[model samples]
Target chain A: MSEIRWDLVKQNWVAVAANRALKPNDFPIAKMGLKAPAAGGFCPFCEGNENFTPPEITAYRPKSQANEKGWLVRAIPNKFSAFTLEGELVKTDSGIFSCYNGLGEHEVIIEDPRHGVEFHDLSPERIETVLNIFKERYQDLSSDARIKYIQIYKNRGMFAGASLEHCHSQIVGLPFVPQENSGLPKYYRDNNRCLLCDMLAQETASEERLICKTDHFTLICPYAPRFPYETWIVPQRHCEHFADINEEEVRDLARVLKKLTGVIMDCLDNPSYNLVFNTAPVNVEPEAGYHWYMELTPRLLVNAAVEIAAGIYMNPVAPELSAAMLREIMS
Target chain B: MSEIRWDLVKQNWVAVAANRALKPNDFPIAKMGLKAPAAGGFCPFCEGNENFTPPEITAYRPKSQANEKGWLVRAIPNKFSAFTLEGELVKTDSGIFSCYNGLGEHEVIIEDPRHGVEFHDLSPERIETVLNIFKERYQDLSSDARIKYIQIYKNRGMFAGASLEHCHSQIVGLPFVPQENSGLPKYYRDNNRCLLCDMLAQETASEERLICKTDHFTLICPYAPRFPYETWIVPQRHCEHFADINEEEVRDLARVLKKLTGVIMDCLDNPSYNLVFNTAPVNVEPEAGYHWYMELTPRLLVNAAVEIAAGIYMNPVAPELSAAMLREIMS
Candidate 1:
């Protein structure tokens, strides 16, 4: 589990995920494609090698035992979690500074049983299973009064910061609402309208940066993307909470996600990318003002000094050009 | 030059520094140490190869002609600028969204004539020259009423986003104050004290994460560092602007910076790092409520899904431990 500390100067929270114990040289090179076997000749998430990992919390093993070989997908507590299930959420104040004991859940959803397979390579059924697990976990974690936000994200390659080669996504239940999402609620209050919904309508009507559209979802390169080939997968209808998504919506999202990932892989030659789900904070009921979405940022460029210092992003490729390239490849 | 566009949804500005038409495959591998010669066998920043870059804005060439070989340091307009000097500060409104032409100055400060030498490796006089040039440019650019902020930053290696291996730093004059700095003025108004000055006093008294101390500066790994081995060099006095530094302060800064970089390089084995100068916005006079400092972040870890999505950082290494390790290496 991770411990959250307050940065007095920046007025933000910093999470120290100390369980990983990664040293300065522990970071792996940004390698693409398949990864070699572990030193012990074991892949924990593999079907038969399930014993290598901790026992399953919940798994889709209809044909087999709880922690058995026939499972297609598995959800387990992250071994090197940033936030732990243990520890009391005690906030301590020293003068003007404050810190809290990192009391939250960190779970890893093994997307597939195969070692070398990627998310896009998984079958639609498997992808749907992954989405269902994510939704279930979101609802379960939201029940906890201590957990305010649940962040579900995936890192596909080395550059995207995946230490393990196995296909997996993470769910981090945080103690507070993140700073980035702090603006949405106020924006909603000021305009009685969901900002993303308005932007989606404009994007769909313009059809300039639109990559693909489905009955349930709309995928487009954002107008002011921080990175090249950055895409957003948003629901056509406004919804505040991701857990509120229905069965039909889940299936549609899975299909659209597969198609979009395929397009990105084809266009960027399997570039390393990160997929992040942006849902509303917990304890807040579904509202008309806030809408949930997922943003996909391909790691084509490195963020350096200017970005770190000023919080300003300098994108070398225009969003219009990236969208056109993706569209051409999709056709 | 780069163009700035307003992201109405996020309520932030995005800079499209599209002058550098970098392709998807243009990003170089994370190469360490000295770079190999380019295929053209010409380094654009080398003293003799002045023609390869845009004309010099200013250079310390007392003995040679302008744009000739004998300069210790040079300042040139970035050929691949994100913001140009030509555009009018015109804001256009389309529905709820707003955009403005990127009307700002982007210049590159060639730190030294030698291609392979790092900033710390340069002589103190050379480093002082670089600082002087930075201050000169900051003072010059702040005179423009349209420009509100000037960011001074250096990306040292390939992973740190340096396109070329030659030693250089960048100065980007922006048309507006960045979102990150917007909180400072308000915080000052509410608290009646500068946030950084308060932080500096606490950090110095604790001295737990202190790396080094000088007459004019105190360097420490911050209490809540976003990255491992992240360090900040803050002046003891409550100076709000970098341009306000006198000659003695500049020389002291150059000496302290060289020592700190040497410590970082020794501890991390020449890891890629970014040095960013945080200063007061233009037209803002020096005040007790706001102070300026430089933050150094080494690119030892790759930021991925969770960090990008949540705006929360989960650092594996603690600042105290990193500072202790750096202290040991320094000793």
Candidate 2:
């Protein structure tokens, strides 16, 4: 089983395990397309197509500056980046105004060397290796004084916003931590309890809505689900950082994730979905409470004006019903 | 010009204006061909379709019975709501346990007698009438002592979760205000300044990102846009609630909205989008340093794992560029 940790500074939860699912190849097989490719035909992430993207920032390849030949997972600068790497993180406040230059590193982590191989489809060993790489990157980025937060996430399938078919996630190092994010951990501190930990215990005890569970983790459609089929994967035991899980936990996580994905695929005829690992900021360590976890949002509804107007969500299907349906399908 | 009020409670800004541009036939037009309709389709809110849903609690039609439909905008109970109407709003202290019932009202607002038109395409006069209806509903629902907040919003198109193409937003009156929402107002009170006011001032002053402006409002792409082409419409002056806006401002809003929609349709090639209004809570009255506004999110990018995990938007195009493009195409 994997351990979940809540990052105090960033207020995100992450799962840490060494025995990650051994089967990454199934990642691609479960995806159903809800969106089409970009109008232009060029896909920069594919193999034999190194020229389409900016120069590689870093890669686990041979020391060749020529092309994208010898590489496992590579990191490249985004062609259409929101924030470039050139600016300095200069912070200045004009009276009550406070802001800094949008300076930091935004690098894309390519998971597979080949095209059409999503993360879940990667081998278990490869998945573990990928997890290690993520930790290493987190550690490396935290060392930089200017960087306040490091974000890692993958967009699979067309609906999940995969510009390219290859499996990958992008890591962004930001200069300033977002205000809402910073408030989350403080909330835990003020309440004298870990928000997620308390919530998880309640959800677990109320097993009427449990979707699936593994040795290390439990997957359930949340009571206050922001979207229909919004499944949350929380660790049975609370930990904080994602980079600190053991091998057994990782393996358990892999098993659980595979099953969760399987259930999703089996039901809803393979809807487009997003899988996100919410870990704490690089600067903060796990404390007395708080836990990290994964939130899976299936694109079952469109987020329109009303949703934007109110922060509250309007999930048509009840969480209990969704859980029941998922359990039945998984069984 | 519409007044932009900083919500002292929600920490969000909203514009109160009756200035709206509504052509008689103008309404949100759903894209053709997304999902397969039911085998034997039925209009769930129609007069005879009462049996299709759970017994309605309140209806406005020639009320021989409450559920019977002669109402302009019908409010019926959600058959499969995420949150139930039952359950006590109990906050127990079971050794650091904190979980509340998913207890709240989830009512669907059916817009038209005919099932053909969306809210966006309705006549200006008709839209104003709908706004009145929304205001009436808010006033009525918020009076419930159990309800602390009333959220009003609409979803258009299948992408936006409109089960029926008829125009309407759902109202969910919660027992208590959510933490994320409540914190915004607190931050405002502590800082003694409006967060959105500062944001809008910075954006308007930048001029580089300003898209379109009406006497009552200014539409600009946010500086750090969470999504590509994320346009925000704000009133030039500060005000609070959406229902409090005068008739003139509504007309101005209608014009600006029509122009904004035209630009989105023409410039982004009529991409699917979500329009959300950020307003103050039900109990909160208009106060200094609070503002209300509308956010238009064009679904240009699929918000996948990276965005969810990192809490940062990866915009493919800069706000400046997007604004310029929109300015070129909009009315």
Candidate 3:
């Protein structure tokens, strides 16, 4: 029977129709459509092609060079940024419409020095270094009084909206907090507890939707996923912002990310995916009942009109089945 | 300069970055990838293949018959339905999760008899008949005490999520009012006006985003569109439900839909698009502020993680630019 389930945190309904009978083997591997870059293709994030991109804001380098090469991980301004750090955050209203000057930061984090190495292939400690850089950027951007929120994410493949084929992540500093985060306050008001912490306890204890777990972090398939095989990595401890992540938590998160991605890649053969961070905003109110988490949604199917209009996500495969398959594959 | 605009109705932010410099010609024609079914493939919606589907609930035929080859338009239960009208609408809660038994209706409206002919190719009179049938279905589904909302939409081409190549639309009778529609009450409380009514007046008066207008309806590019070339066809009258549409209004609406879709098809080179209808729910309150409208979103680019997570839509081609191009092309 199909079940219409409510997502507590996202505040949306997901219709899980198990009768669709989509087993693990039935899913299409999106990486099959992903083409490798042409031989000698000019990738801006490549070591020698650093001149093609904006100068590095920060880099993990042994030498004192800025952008000329020899950096393990690099961070630079996006060439085609959606937001810029130039204008004042002045808001204007015209009848029913309102707008703000897009005064924020958009930076790209190049994952590795080698062009072909993906983030999932890197060791957990190496990934932890990248995680540390994300935390540093979050903290650094938080100090900017104009910025209200920070969004960090990775679009992994061509199908996942990655313009550049090179493996890189993006950190966007937004002038205002988004309306989608209203679920935080809604959940907190309804139940005087941290949303993700409660969800993490529920998901782990149920064990039906548990994919994998580490010392500090646990990966679980959400009960009401918007997409099939949608997974979330929640920390065991309650934290308000991702920038507040400690070194040990970062290490465990890195380990959990690598393990979960490995299992998902093997399960669906490296499907085009989006890795998104969900954290508390810098200058937002009701700051106590927020918990930071990460969502990894594999781009398996296109969302139809019903999804775009009504916010009713149609997930054919049940999360319990998907989590069971993921656990089996991981073992 | 780029601006982060607020969408009053959708409660989301749209960052319009003209720096990306996407003009009318920059978008790719998604229909280039949309292949006609096959030389001799079996299409259930075809004229002689009436037996391939479930018996028609209702169809427009010259003579009295249930399922026949002479039907112009047909409505039938979805073969692989997401919701079935069976069992009771029982709501269950466990821990932080809540769910309802999927006891609702899902129907397919085959638009035309001929397989080669598309909806855009239909004459205004012919399209009006389809609109009438949609209204009839809406009214019929409203009588179901368990159903709460009826979402009518057309997912055209492969990218927009049409499984079969037959030109058709779907009507889903959901058991609950979707959470995306909170804007209706929010608008009423904040401004003491209907959202679409105010937006219609603003767009028509400004003329900056107006694409076309008719006696009973108007088509305009929205202030903060989620995707580039996104358009809305809103009725001029202040009706809460599309089911309340009169004969004259339906005829004018058909004309408006035809003209707008024709302009959009020409503009985007027959892009794969989703045609979604937004109206009041059947079994919900605060319906005074609701206004019925139709949305047409052409699928041009894959939304990245920032869009999926933070609900910040990135539209490279500003609505003003797209609307001007559309008007110019229409003239």
Candidate 4:
């Protein structure tokens, strides 16, 4: 039976099935220890674990010996990569739907050879080095005119499908801009202002739902949060490329990140979460009007049917309450 | 460090941070349990649970007494609804951004007060009765011209975030079409063929990736699945409205659902899953050219940073293998 309900804020539809209401105990928290470290002899990113993965494409170490150690950051080909080097970008039409070869580069960024260090735990110097690496890699990959967009992200824990037990992130370059990327930028072009900046301003002015604010960055739980406890970190200024961040801004970004993670851990009992960076297209210039920002989503509730069915969000906790909870922990 | 890898098939960007890899065990799964069911002792959806929720909007069975006994299905207003009947649809332009008042209806459909009954366990006659109920309520909600879309969904386990232990679903009607729904359909319109239809055809043609296919329906793990063991149940025909389904089709739909849920239980040790339906917009005719179907995604893996950053998907197991593994499970 359908007793129809509409989420007014999100304007999404939901039909609650009366036959399957669930209690808290019936649900299992995502088991963190399910995946042990890959047991394939040696890990490619580790100090002595070079043989386990494909040859390293790049590394941040003194150009002394061939591959004998002393690397702060390393780039290696993924052993079980989803995309690879050989295929050409050939598009074939099948009736009305068009598809092409699953070709492209899939590489892993190994932050440190030491197994358990997370991105937030990295020293400020190391974090800056990682930022520089991102800029360098983006410039190199964008040289291929076929590539249209580059996406950078980090999966933190088992809930985020990180099979390996190392603190790392992934970079993917694509041959086309997704509908979301293209459409989002179009909104910017139409309004002649950064969408996120506008949103940040509105959130700051309201202040009722503000979580944390600083000179360089602002963190807030979006009013229409797609997931519960979803937080966004945006620059106070309208900047397109993440790589364009100055040294001072990078440190600010680092501080923002540390505080963001700290709040999440304190508020949600250190729940597993994912952090993603959304920036402008690789080939685009600073004036292209894309907003670069990071979104950190803690896996508090299991997202199943409602999210998948409707594009609208179902955040049970009101944004005001969510902000209040996070604010308490932040202080 | 970021290695921007491009998924040639999906044509989306992916950022691979090998140096920033997260081990599987780093995420701690929330312990499974039932808590909120006993809270305050005013739970309305439970047997004699009528006092906890709002007054009934609709009810089935026993028309003799006024809301007294033996109701097969009951439709009632949500206690803490996201959308309230009191607000007006006042759209305000704040600078350049668009926002509106949270105005609409939110209700719950209580299937059976008895706990522990999975939807698949319901008799076919009972399932048909439920279908009739769905149709009746949908017609009732669509009477208001202001409502644009109606959504129906069921979240099963604690992982799926069901607050109560009783079996039920919620229905919410909205005033606007979501971005994804409005945008994804554009692809279908541009191609003059349903987007999902073409996708289903490809998977059906390649039976190796097919999980279950009947005359009316076909279920398969999608190629380039966003999450592992993600399965889709699509109608064989191009029916946009769920209400268009006849008696036989409803029976078949239930059968397919039961089979898939059985696979999920057996294959992944009864992992919690989300069952979502994407149907045609309420009040809108079927000429819009989109197909209606359900997406069954098991909470097998948390959506990490890579997925959120890049719209591209990274499925570890091939769909063919996943389908085969699922098919082997005895329902």
Best by lDDT: 1
lDDT score for candidate 4 against the true structure: 0.62
TM-score of 2: 0.73
Q: Write one digit per residue (lDDT tens) for candidate 3, span A116-227.
A: 7887998998888899899999999999888889999999875577766677899998877775556666677777876677777887788988987778888887766665
Between candidates 2 and 3, the TM-score winner: 3
B209-313: candidate 4 lDDT, tens digit per residue: 587778798887654444456677888888877777877888877667666776576656666667666777765554455677777776655555655445444
| TM-score (second chain) of model 4 | 0.79
TM-score, every prediction: 0.94, 0.73, 0.87, 0.78
CA lDDT scores, all candidates in order: 0.78, 0.58, 0.74, 0.62
**What RMSD value applies to candidate 1?**
2.6
- Which stretch of 10 consecutive residues in model 2 chain A shows the poorest summed lDDT? A21-30
Model 3 CA deviation exceeding 4 Å by range: A1-37, B1-36
How does candidate 3 score on lDDT? Answer: 0.74
**Candidate with maximal DockQ:** 1
Model 2 chain B scores worst on lDDT over the 10 consecutive residues at B21-30
Q: Name the docking class for model 4.
A: incorrect
lDDT of 2 by residue, B209-261 (tens): 78767787888875545555668888876776666667777777777765676
Displacement of the residue B228 alpha carbon in candidate 3, Å: 0.5
